[model samples]
Target: MTGDFRYRLERGGVKYACPACRQQRRFVRYVDTLTGEQVADEVGRCDREDSCGYHLRPSEYFRQTGTKPPTAAARRKEPMPEPEPSSIDAETAGRSLTGYGHNNFALWLCSVFGEEIAFRLVDAYHVGTSRHWPGASIFWQQDVTGKIRGGKIMLYDAVTGRRVKEPFNHVTWVHKALKIELYHLRQCLFGEHLLAADPVKPVAVVESEKTAIVAAGFMPEYIWTATAGKGNLKVVKLGLLRGREVTLFPDLGAFEKWKAAVDQMPGVRVSDVLERRASEEDRVAGLDLADFILREQAINV
Candidate 1:
């Protein structure tokens, strides 16, 4: 096979299911440049960079399929540009700002720090109350463009400040619940909007949305944002953190994995604060930055 690449990434909004992860619309298929068709459904790259790193090139596909490659003489058309990421309507997101009074997470925040500071934290992060559960809250992931990408809905106990898992792990997405068909959910870091608000301040990133909120209440200097979970520490999500000082606080037992992932990017550092301080019992419980900060607050009081 001659060195001229026969196919290119099929750009536009038509994403197929990833062959590896099997997640619908996350795979960018490799198109046959000569025919303007896909090499195969499975021949593409998965969009879940952090969790599902799968890329099957056209050359590799042809080799595996035992198909003849397109000769260098075959004319190739340039692929169309990719579509912009989807965003929730401003009106819909605006409507969610209310009803935080019934939000379990918000209620817990108020109980710990009082209503004044609690409301401030809620406003800063665009936290919303969800009627999906009796006392659930939505952690809306807003980008620097002021777009609402999606919201992570989770239920918590107002008194314990811990997630409720009795009736099954209470978690869902706003996009899914709204019945938005073909909704392309591109997750930005939770509290990402704070980067634009406090540009000069160094950024402190953690895994949990609740941790980001509670840590912000205690450490106001750092612009706190969250990866939203352990598996969400993707390069694309952290792209906005470039040119700024960034520190990632991984959950217990996840320090090594997170450090390896972020090591490729310059100007980014993963903190060992939890790793250094946690006891074996704390590690077993999988505690995070919020646990440490909250425990310290309780001890001081």
Candidate 2:
């Protein structure tokens, strides 16, 4: 019997009330592949972005219920194959650092934080420009051990510093773009390489690479890093933070999602700054830490 491991919307085409808001047709439930059953009634997401944002992953459900989901070995009749470790050599990582003239994000950073600080941030994070699209920047995910795992390429508006998602949702990975076959890509936290630079500084994590850079510029006290996305905050990727003080500054709509995920993680704390201070308008706009910092900077100026 061949089976695949994935999650799909429960009862396709049927409307289900959201667990959080009770809104109909927005809820999507996770279905267990092995048992051919819904894992949990509330283990899914609500599509409503503004009013109701509820997403409970299978992993979160398992953690909450104190139950272990079926392992790969158990799920498949055949023996599970081990995945190979993927790596980007130092040379490739070095080559990416060469072109900063067309790096719009870097140029924008230079304007906001000034040349010295912006150059430092770029060098520290291995921020690169891609000829793939003019003004496209690469946020390389270098591991704590100084290995280049991969890079996430994204296009941003130079003046606004906002990501350009329309006309294609401009995002791609270095590994995929290079067509590195058999490369088992495993992404670590963005800016993770900074951990090796300062063993004493407490780590502050956000959801976007832009936020990390901006936050780091304003508050040099804490080492700022990003998960790259809310869902990418996995326990495995956080292993390097074992004994270190770690704080999560999730985006406005992501506080609960991150809080629940890190409950069992020792030495990890979630910041409630945005949750406590944000107005309904800010929440609706999906404001993040970077937005907060910029607002304060503008006020002080």
Candidate 3:
């Protein structure tokens, strides 16, 4: 038997009924590469890893079920262990905590929430201003353990609070800018580090760092965090938030995709506020929760 089985957990966070507990959206099914289908109904992992340890890999499934997977080409080589991602020094993070006076994003935040509240939120998030672009802000992604994962540098319009996308979408990473060689980026949520401050606080997750900051202003009840970008959603990284009460707010056109992500994450819920309230124009513009919130608060932007 050629060991060319390219079995993998299916993408889009599609979960099924757990064979062990008969629970829905907790089981991750395995898929056969060649056939473009699931290996078996019972072959997969249950997201309830602690409470219900039900895991059946494809090879084990074939062996026990008395079935041979179709052979393909070469024997699969042993996979190499991945290197641990690099972290920025705390000193670097400290140095960035300056220049906020000239930061466009910081100015916009002040305009929305007034100077006192705006600066308080900025200090709490440890957000920094950057010299990378004129009036750029750096949203540093720190882990729950307080390690600096990475910094996202982006230029924003001082008045509108919108990212400056006209002049080629000014965005870059701090690590890349430093010319750090072979830097492997393993990102956590944008403001995940705040969880340690209040472990029991429910987290409100959005698609942009700016949204997280804005939402935190209005709703001090929930710990607002951002995934940095929609494509930045990774199951394993998000699974770190398993025990916490988390709510996801995806952009207008991205509801289904983020809903699928919420499925794999057992207790997490996806908010349908945007989907329920947005007009066709709002959908076409792909507005986020922060936009609706600002309007609700009557904060002219």
RMSD of 3: 14.9
Q: Name the runs in model 3 displaced over 4 angstroms.
A: 1-76, 235-239, 298-301
Measured with C-alpha atoms, the lDDT of residue 172 in candidate 1 is: 91
Using lDDT, rank the candidates from best to worst.
Answer: 3, 1, 2
Better of 2 and 3 by lDDT: 3
Model 2 CA lDDT for position 189: 88
Across 1-301, the per-residue lDDT of candidate 1 in tens digits comes to 2422767888888888888888988999888777777878788889899999999887787788888665545544556555676788878887888887788899999999999999999998899888989989988988887988898889999898999998699999998889888888878888888888766788888888899889889888788888887888872345687777888888878989998898788888888777788899987887667889898752111
User: How many clashing pairs does model 1 include?
Assistant: 0
Comparing 1 and 2 on TM-score, the stronger one: 1
Those runs of model 2 whose alpha carbons end farther than 4 Å from true positions after fitting are: 1-82, 235-238, 298-301
Q: Which tens-of-lDDT digit does each residue in 144-194 have in candidate 3? A: 888888899999999989989985989999998898989988888888888
TM-scores for all candidates: the values are: 0.72, 0.71, 0.72
Q: After superposition, how far is residue 211 of candidate 2 from its true place, in Å?
A: 0.5
The lowest-lDDT stretch of 10 consecutive residues in candidate 3 is 70-79
Tell me the alpha-carbon RMSD of every candidate.
Answer: 15.4, 18.0, 14.9
Tens digit of per-residue lDDT, candidate 2, span 76-151: 7656676755888888867889677788899889889899999999998899888778889999998888888888
